[model samples]
Target: MTEPPSLKKEPIGRLISYIHRTQQKRLSRSLSEYGIGGGGQYSFLKGILMTPGTTQDQLTCNLKFDKATTARSVKQLEAAGYIERTTDPEDRRSHRLYPTPKALKFQPVLQAILDEGNAKLTRDLTDEEEDQLIALLQKLNLEE
Candidate 1:
């Protein structure tokens, strides 16, 4: 009897990692056009835009980032005039994050870049194929 071909174990992780790295590089290049650098800053900005007035702890949980990294990103964003922190009225000891007008102004540029990236990533895929891919990814997340 003929033997079936064996699948390589390493290719799955390696392929996924390579794809992630390439996407990050592309995103970094896009962000650089707007004077922003680093993945953390982009992530923080996205999170703040999604949940204005979010606290540091809330950001950490939402982004799955550690406290130190989130705090550093927040500090850098604040200094860059992209975000501001206000004391929570209910809890003076805690601060809430909000995007500055400067940051809001960049929303269109950021959204354009994201839309372009999404278009490129799904360029050749049919709607069904895209849906299947998304479903598979969701399944993997559920497994986690």
Candidate 2:
């Protein structure tokens, strides 16, 4: 027996694209109520919360985002009072990013939103399957 042409074609790209779109739509809707925009601001929030005092350049590098996009996201986050920028003592021209009290206060809510999305994604999988899927994803995403 032969598989269908669609099924026989590259599966990873389609699967990943579908998952990305689904998560983006759901997360955008969930985070909009908190005043976060449609882009991946939640990820940046989590990044700053986890690693305080990182600079905008660091964020751009760490997030693999372009300079302009990172700058825009930082500006939006600052405008919304979720993050603050302090002058980098080492580099007078650069500034360090930090999560504000408002962002810290809402961290749990943001985490819950992420957890809910993960749960939805894995709702049909068993614990072992979920673990296996995560392992496979990590393996595939490993940097050279």
Highest lDDT among the candidates is held by which one?
2
**Residues 1-144, model 1: lDDT tens digits:** 989999867775677788778877888888886766775678888889889999999999888888999989899888888899999999999999999999999878777887887778888999999899888877765223
Residue-wise C-alpha lDDT for candidate 2, range 81-136, written one tens digit per residue: 99999999999999999999999999999999999999999999999999999999
Regions of model 1 farther than 4 Å from truth = 1-10, 142-144
Error of 2 at 92 (Å): 1.0
Q: Residue 114 CA error for candidate 1 (Å)?
A: 1.4
Residue pairs with colliding backbones in model 1 are none
Say which candidate scores most in TM-score.
Answer: 2
Q: In terms of TM-score, how similar is model 2 to the real structure?
A: 0.89
How does each model score on TM-score?
Answer: 0.83, 0.89
- In terms of lDDT, model 2 sits at 0.92
